[model samples]
Target: MDSDELREVLQEAGLSPYQSKAYVALLELGTASARELVEASDVPDPRIYDVVRSLEDRGYVETYEQDTMRARAHSPADVLDDLQNRASRFEQAADEIEDRWEQPELDRHAASIVKRFETVVDRARLFIQEAENQIQLSASIEQYEQLRGVLADALDRGVYIQLSIYTNPDDDVELPAEEQLAATTTEARHRPIPSPFVALIDRQKACFGPHEDALNEYGVLVDDRMHEYIFHWYYSSCLWEICDEIYSSRNDEPPIEYVDVREFIRDVEPMLLDDLSVGVRVVGKDVSTGEERELEGEVADVFYEGDDYRGTREIPLAQLAGRASVTVATDEGEFTVGGEGAMLEDVEAMRLTITSASE
Candidate 1:
């Protein structure tokens, strides 16, 4: 636009201040001797020669040894091509930044830190859709609504859904009724206070975000079982356990199913202690081989770290934090079954159903 701005553009394009001035002066002069360039550019006469040589090296100008050393600006064709290429690169880079912002790439076996909490919730849809046997979720009422349809689809597929929806206690939010929630989730809870949005799917993948009102907005996407384990506990103790169940479509009678070992232990531990026979069928992965397997048997024994604890509503998540397993007596033999991603057991259970109960 202006002479000063044009000079600035040239300087920003890798020309030194003096080179920019000298080149601009040469272009206006059409063809100039060293003395003429010094007069037009206002560059110190002593530095003009070296500046012209630098411009010549960059193909911005050409110099010839004449009666008094003549110099002239180059055709500018190559310079225009370079600028166009740079513009294209900048445009491509901008698009890539937007794409990555919208869908942050997550590592399959590690955590990926993402910029926005919304990104975590949005990406979690696919994980929720792929849920095989279990899903643990905590959401704001809005977030819950956003995921309600997918959760309903998963429920129709017989995936165990545990959801906790929260809002500020002061806000008189019209919460969903039990009848409405039962269609989407197996169990749902409500928190009168704010909580982070968390989704743990099939004990293998997790999406975690800070409270929506947090000053810094960030989230974590985890595909690691160990990372998922930590997120699972967080969801359990803070979000799910204390909250009162608002809606449940759980089958309260025989043939009750549990996707979590801790829950399985809680319900069936009482039956086992009562000397009632609880028959179970477990679908899970083999601990040693990581292959999917289904095992059916009668409950043999229940084991955990603490002797005083028999899994019940009163038992805290911390109590269930240590080793907990179900030993089943099949026709083949008695084998131990643990929770999802269970490392120290015979099988990592995805779902365990009490197929029969006998007095």
Candidate 2:
């Protein structure tokens, strides 16, 4: 690089303009008297001595009497070593200062803004890895691809994930199949609209922003539990409610285990002991003619046979005809309608699909 450019680099490394100019001049001239430096560099004659003195103190130059007073610039390697040593010391001090710093308390609703897209990506990774119990997020396929590694690690740690994601209908991006089968992924839904980059972790923290490439891209991180709850509510009530659950696997097989509510009552009953509702698909079979039939109507019930779990689910109305009994587990995704009925099942294979009973 030219002397002018090298001088600019030196200035960037914390040298004063006068010092950088004088050093570059000396390096170029090999050795220079006071007048020679003033002529070769932008440093004024009156300030040349002071600049050279400062350079000598910083170990970037050496001054000595050789007929006339002279200053010789240190080799570039030596100068850079000096700059690096100072930088290291500054970093060490900074680490010590941060160790002794106390974080100020902020309002629960307060959010801190990050102005860089790179920083936003970094903060998202931090939140995903720090999550303990659950992570709820909405993203475009591109956004999730950027975060796939950190998210996979979170899943490996047993964090439950509820994702509302969509592929860019116009783009060629495809969702990875392995991610669809992750054990920690409790539910994966397809959102039609584009999703702002956002995530809530453990109901304790949230980060949100526009797409990464948007003009003046920025993000905000809210650390309040109350704010976290609000983000989660918005995700569930607004985004999640409208998304379609991914019911079929890559091989077209249903990922959820479907069992006859009556035949598997002993095994299924214990699974439903929790207060949370379970999804089930109901089917009807004939006892006499060995014919199987399905119907549609609004009728549902949960009963126990001396603690043995027994449930009857009817398909949605449109085909109400048979005695509906066996309930197959289904999800509350867009594909499933909520009600007690048998009319809907008759339209298909007399099959009622439900959310995974194991979740």
Candidate 3:
């Protein structure tokens, strides 16, 4: 490499300017005294000893004592190995510290943003490794193009694979490079889902995103075990079961038309409402009095009188900020009640829980 590039690399390797120059000089000259080193390199005389000592401590240099002290630079391979080892140690320590301090929040937001294909690809890679028994993938031609390699890798390792593709009928379907790798080693199959999102990876991970036209607008990976479990319940037990029946009967028709009220609500509201408890606020003028009254608490029930118009009744709690309130529990004392509007706002910001302090 050129001097400029080498210097930049040294900087990345955690070397100071003078240290890099001094080390490079030693490398060229083999062995040199402090005076010779100072004259040959850009390092000043006063800082030479400190720089030499730093290099020696880092195992990049060896110092010899005689009438005059001399130092020799270590081989590039040895120096590079030492630097890499030190870096690995630092990274392991940092990961431990972060695990203790930031893991809870880190896992929550790791796949929230879908800025680039790389982020989704990485999440898919992680999911493949985490998958113990099964993987279900549904994606557009474009998404599958990016994820083919990850799927193939998982299949090679003996993980069960089931993939569904959503593409135009005229579009040519081909496995991604990675998927091709696993195709020979694992069970691989594909079908079509009308929707563009992909959701299958054992019961541990799920990647949901937009169709081709809206690709840049939405994408998310759910890695949390609790979230994945809930999704599996709905997808496997409810959605996929009916989808299987439809496929077997060659009924390529929309299944919602056949679903009962309970299934209809589940299909319409993709949001898992079982583990979810909602808060509601009613703001209206009392019919008996001319005064305005607001009632807010955990939503006991939500009923719709007509399309686009919904009514909710919540147990009254102490009033808080505008139309919001705090529910006082018998044992837990008091906790703020956040309504559906607030929940929607939170979701847009990539937040999952209203109880988050940062929100």
Which residue window of length 10 is worst by lDDT in model 3?
A: 344-353
The clash count for each model shown is: 0, 32, 5
Candidates' C-alpha lDDT = 0.80, 0.56, 0.47
TM-score: which candidate is best?
1
Give candidate 1's total backbone clashes. Answer: 0
Ranking by lDDT: 1, 2, 3
Candidate 2 lDDT, 1-359, residue by residue in tens: 44566566677778899987787667656556899999999788889899998987776666655467876553233454544565554444333222222122222555655444444455576778788766877877766777777777887886657777866557665564654536435567787656677788765688888764467666667778667756765776666756788632222233233222222233334455543344454443433332554433221333332321123232222222123333332232122221222233322122344434334
Reference-based TM-score of each model? 0.69, 0.43, 0.34
- What would you estimate as the lDDT of candidate 3? 0.47
Please give the distance, in angstroms, between residue 171's alpha carbon in candidate 3 and its true position after superposition. 2.9
Tens-digit per-residue lDDT, 1-359, candidate 3: 45555555676668899987887677666667899999988899999999999988886766655357877653344444544565564344323322322212213422343333333554565666666556766555566656666666675675545545454556666544443534522322334444545565654477665556563654566766556645555544433433322112112222212111122222222222343443323332233342443443342322222333122122211111123222312232332322222231111110111211110
Q: Which stretches of candidate 1 lie over 4 Å from their true place?
A: 1-105, 310-314
Those runs of model 3 whose alpha carbons end farther than 4 Å from true positions after fitting are 1-111, 170-194, 233-359
lDDT of 3 at 190: 39
